[model samples]
Target: MKYWNLKKINQSAFEKTGIVPRSMSKLFNRFKQELNPNAEVEALEEFKVAKYQTSTSIKYIIVLLITPILINQLSKISVLDPLVNHLWNKNSNYIFLNPSQEERAFADLQRFEEKLHFEILIGKLDALSAENVNNKMSNKALAIALEYSQESVNAIKNIIADFISIIIFVSIIITNKRQFSILKSFINELIYGLSDTAKAFLIILFTDIFVGFHSPHGWEIVIEAILRHFGLPESRDFIFIFISTFPVILDTIFKYWIFRYLNKISPSAVATYHNMNE
Candidate 1:
C-alpha cells in the first residue's frame, strides 16, 4: 500500500484536468481584480453547487479572524520586551554619553513601548468585546480619542489585512471550481504548514516560561553565556533583539520549508491551483 503520495494525487488531478498554472504575479493580480464590490455575492453563487466548498470557505474566514487573535496573544507574552529593556539599560552608559543619539533612541523606544501597550489593549478589547455596547459618548469625542490612539490605527490595519486575506481565499475557491481538489489540497498544506509553525512557537514559548519560572532572567543569562562562549558581543540590547526576533525568523523559515516540501511532494497540486486561474 502506498503510504504517502501527494504527488500521485496531484498527478491524477493534472491528468484528469489538463490545466496549466499561471505566474505568481499574474495570479495575484487576478485575485486583486476579482475583489469587486459584487465579488462576495458572485463567490457565493459560484460555490452554491458544492456545499462542502462553501463550508470550506467559511472555515477559511474563521481562520482569518482567528489569526490576529492568536498573534495578539503571542505578543502579550512579552518575551522580547524584557530583553529589549534590559539591553537598553546595559547600553545606557554609552548611550547616555552621546546625548543627541540617546535622546532620539530613547524617544523612539518610548514610542515603541507605547505602541506595544496600545496593541495589548486593542487585543484585550477585541477578545472581550463580542457585543457592541451603546455608549452615550458623542461621535466627536470618540473620533478625537481614536485619532490620538496609535493602537486604533494598528487595529484598522489589522482589520484591513484580515479582510483582504479572506477575500483572496474566497476568490480562489470561487474562481477555481474545476480545480477544487487541487485548491483543497493546497489549503490543507497551508493549514499544516501553519500548524507546524505554531507547534515550534509553543515549544519555544513553554521552554522560555519554564526557564523563567525556575530562574529569574534565565533566558538572558543563557543567551549571554552563549555569546560569551562564542567571543561575541554580549550587550543586553544585542542579545535582546536577537532572542526576540530569532524565533519569528526561524518560524518563517520553517514554514517556508514546509511549503517547499509540500510542493515537492505534490507539484501537480500547486500547478493545478496556479493554472486554474489561467
Candidate 2:
C-alpha cells in the first residue's frame, strides 16, 4: 500500500475546488480531525507529537548552552592556539582595537596635558619646562597604547571563538532537519495557543521594547557595544542611519505579518490587540 501525503492531497483537493485561503483550509482540517472515527488513534498521534517536540526542545536547549563553551575550550588547547596565533595574530594590529581607539588615546593625552597646565596655573605644583611636559605626555600615551593593544588581542580571541561557535550552530541546524521541523511546530503552537489577551500583551511588549519611541536610545547603546566587541569603528552616522531605517523596516514587517498571517489565523487575537492598543 502506498503512503498518502495528506498535505499534498489537501493542496490538490483545494486546487480542484478553487484557490482556498490557508486559514480556511486549516479550519477544515481541524474540523475533520475532531470528527475522525479513530479518536483513540488521534490521541495517540498527538501524544507522540508532544513527546517528539519535548525531546527536540530539550536537545536544542542543551546544544545552545553547551556548544559555545565546548568550542571555546577546544579552541584554547595548546595544539590549536599556537597555530591560530601564528596565522591570525601575525598581521593583527597590536597597537589598538581600531582607529577610534587611537583617537581616544590621543584625546585622553590632550586632556591630561590641559589638566597639568591648569594645575600649574593654580600653583598646585612646581612649574615644568616644555621638555618635561613633552616627556610626561609621551609616557602617558605609551601606557595607554600598551593597555589598548592588550585589549585588542583579547577581543580578537573572543571574535575567533564566537565565529567557531556560530559555525557549529549552523552545522547542527543543517544536519537535523527532523528536529528542526519539530521545534518549529512546537514554537508555532506555543505562540498560537496563548489566550487573546496574552497574545495582545506579548505583542505590545515586543513592540514597545523594540520599535517604540524610547527604543532608539536602546538601539544606539546595543550598536555601540556590538561594534566595540568586533573592534569595528563606531561611526555615529552609520548608527543613526541604521536606527532610522532598520526599526521602521522591522515595524513594517511586523505589521505585515499581523495583517497577513495573524489576522487570518487568529482574528480574535488581532481584534483584542487593536482594542488594547487603543
TM-score of each candidate structure, all chains considered together:
0.21, 0.75
Worst 10 residues of 2 by lDDT: 1-10
Q: What is the lDDT of residue 265 in candidate 2?
A: 69
Encode model 2's per-residue lDDT on 86-181: one tens digit a residue.
755576556776788788778888899899999999999789999998998889888887777766665677678778888888888888765565
lDDT of 1 by residue, 148-181 (tens): 2323233334444445555665665576554565
Q: In model 2, which regions exceed 4 Å deviation?
A: 1-41, 76-94, 110-139
Identify the runs in model 1 with alpha carbons over 4 angstroms from their true place: 1-49, 93-278
Q: What lDDT would candidate 1 get against the real structure?
A: 0.47
Which residue pairs collide, candidate 1? 20-275, 21-275, 87-236, 87-237
Q: Who wins the lDDT comparison?
A: 2
**In model 1, where is the ten-residue run with the lowest total lDDT?**
128-137
lDDT of 1 at 260: 55
RMSD of each: 22.1, 5.4
